[model samples]
Target: MASIGLMGEQGVSAEAVPSLHERDLLLRRLADLAVLPPGRVTPQERALVDMVMATAVSRLDVAQRCRIAERVAQLPEGPRELTLALARDTIEVAAPVLAEAANIQGSDLVEIVRVTSMDHRLAVASRKILPPAAIDALIEYGNTDVLRRMLENRSIEISSRSMEVLVRRSASEPELHAPLLERPELNQRLALLMFWWVSSGTLRVEILNRHAVERRMMHIAIADVLEGGLAASGADEALRVALSLVHPPATIAKPQLTRLVNLATLGQREEFVMELAREARLRPETALRIVSDFGGEPLAVLAKALGLSRQEFGDLIVAVAELRSGYVPAKSDIERITAVFDAISTDRADLVLHLWDWSISGEAQFPLPAEE
Candidate 1:
C-alpha cells in the first residue's frame, strides 16, 4: 500500500499535500477495503488497509471521516481496528459506528462508554443490542439522559442489577420514571418500591395495576403450614404477616377508625401511624410507610382491605395529605383516591396489603414462589 504521507512529521511540502478529492478518494478506498468479506479480501490486503487507515484517518476532515464511518458501520465483518478508530472519533464521526456497527466487540464498547462524551454514550445506548458489560459501564458513567436512552431502547436486555441501580436512581431522577417503568426488565418488587416516590398519577396507577398481584397461590402453598402452626411459631415473619391477612382479626371499629383519621387531620403524624398500626394489626413501620406514601394509592388499598367506605377513604386521603406539611388535598386528589379505592376488590387489596407488609419487612423477592 502506498503511504498517504499526510502526517505533519513527514515534512511534505504544502504544494505536495493531497488535494481534497485525493483525500476523499483515499478515505473511500479505505472504507471499501474495510467492508470487503474475508473471502474477498486477503490477510495481506486487510493488514495494509488497517495500516493505511491508522495513519490516513487522522488526516481526513470530519465529513470525510464520517462518510467512512457511515459506510463501515454497515459491514457484516469489518476490520475491528478500523471500527475502533472511527468509534473513538468526535461524536459526529463516531455516532454511526457506535450506534450501528456489529463488528465492535463488547469489551471495546465498554471502553468507549467509559472514555467518551455523553453524546458517544447516548449513541452506544441506542445500539440494537447492548452487552451486559457495556450496559454496566454505561450505567456507571452515564447521566440521566444516557440512562433514559438505554431504558427506552427496547432491544437492550438490561441486567437485574442494572435495573436495580436505575430504579434507585429513579427516586430522584424524575425524568427516568416513564422510560424505566416501560422497560421490560422492571419486576414487581422494584415497581412497588418505586411506587412511594413516583408522583405521576398515571404511573402510580400503572404500578398498582401491574404489580398488585393476588396471593391465591401463596395462600394455597402455605395452607398446610398455617394449619400446622408454623406461622404462629414465627418460622418466617413474612409468612406470619401473610397468615394474618388470611385470617384477619376483628376489624377496627368505625369509631376507633374515625379517631385515627382525626389524628391525621390534626397533623398528629406519630399518633396516627401508631393508632392505625394497632388497629390494622400492622407493624408500626409498615403503617408508617403506608401513611407516609404521598401517592395515596397504598393507603387507599389499605383502606379498601379494611373495608372502609368510599367516604372514609376520601377522609383518610384528606387527613394524610394534611399530615404531610404544606400539602393540601385537591378535589382531583380526592377523586383519584376514591377511584383507586373503588377499583380494588377486597381480596386483591388484602393481597397487596400482605405484599406491602412483606416488602416493609425486607423479605420481598422477584418471582416470589407464589408468582412463579
Candidate 2:
C-alpha cells in the first residue's frame, strides 16, 4: 500500500520519504516480528513485514540499523531480506548479524565475504559455525588477521584443502603458525610439511609430538608381504618406503662422513643429497628435503638416523647453514637442533626419515593406517 524509494536518488517523490519517527516505528515492528514464535506470524504477513523493514532499513542511521542487526542476530528466525541487507551494510551494522544470526544461509555468508570489507570478513570469520564454502571464501579473500581468527575459532572444521592453503601461506606469515597448529583438523602430513618453516621451538615440538606416529598397524599388515618377498622387488614405491620403516636393512653403504659435510658446505646440494640418500637408505628426493629444509630439525633427524657423532653433527649444521646465503645459526638454533638429535634415538630418527620418504614419494594419499 506504500512505496519506499532510495534515500538520495534523483527521482524520489516527497510522499515516499518516511520521516525518522516512521522509520523507527517500522524498525520496532520488524524487531517485534523477528521474535515471534514460529507459527504466530503467517508467511504472507512475514513477507510484507520483511519488505517494509528492508526498505526502511537503508534509510535509518547506522546506530539504528545496528540495533536492528543486534536484535535480529538473537532470533531463531528473522526476515531473510532484512538480515541480508543489514549484513551487507557497514561493519558496525553487519558484525552482529554476520557473527550470530542463526538463519543466515551459508551461501549468503559466502556472498558477504566476497564483496565486503576486511571488518566484514572478520565478522564472518568470527561466526561460531562456518560452512566449508564460507571457510574457503574467507581463506581465498582474507588476510592474515582473518585467517588467524578462523583458525583459532576451534568451533569449525577446516577442510583439508583450506588447511593446505593456510599451511603454505604460513611460510610467509609466521603469525599464523600457532593458531594453525592449534586446529584439530591439522593432520600429520600438513604438520610435517609445516615443519620446514615453522620458527618456534614450541610449535616444532607440537608438530613432532602430534605427528611423529609409528606405523605399527602398517608394520603388521605388510609383515607377511615383506617376508614373502612381495615388497622386496615388485611392490610399489609406497610399499617399499613403508617396508623400510618396519625393517631397515642391516648395513647401508656409508659415505665418508667428512665428504658429506664438505659437499654441504660447498653448496653442492645435488651431491650432498645423493650421498645422504645412499647413506640413509632414503630416496634422493627425501634427502633433498632434509638438506633444503629451512629449519634444522629435519637435518638433525637425518644426522641422528645416520649415527653421526656430536662433532660431526655440529659440522653438518655449519655446512647446511652455509647453503643459505647470509644465514648464520645462532647458539640457540644449534642447541635446539642438538636437543632434537639427542632426544630421538637412532631407531626413531630412522622411522621419521622413512615417513618423509613415504610422504614425498607421492604416496601420502595412501595414508598409513592408524595405529591400533
Q: How many backbone clashes are present in model 2?
A: 0
Q: Model 1: per-residue lDDT, tens digit, 1-372?
A: 864333222223467556865665656666667667788678888978877786678677787677778877888777778889999999999999999999898999999999889999999999998999999999899999999999989988999989887887776788999898888888876787777667588888888888776667767876667666853556576667656656432356899988988898888989988898877777788898888766677888889888888887777777787788858667787679778898888767776676667555653433222211
Which TM-score value belongs to model 1? 0.80
TM-score of 2: 0.80
Query: Which 10 successive residues of model 2 have the least lDDT summed?
Result: 3-12
Model 2 misplacement above 4 A: 1-18, 215-221, 227-269, 292-295, 309-332, 358-372
Give the TM-scores of the predictions, in the order they appear.
0.80, 0.80
**In model 1, which residue pairs have backbone atoms overlapping below 3 Å?**
none
Alpha-carbon RMSD, each predicted model:
6.5, 7.2
Candidate 2 lDDT tens digits, 274-359? 98798887899788778876668888888877888788888888887777763767888888888988887776677777766765
Clashing pairs in 2: none
Q: What is the lDDT of residue 3 in candidate 2?
A: 26
Rate residue 314 of model 1 by lDDT.
Answer: 72
What is the lDDT for 274 in model 1? 89
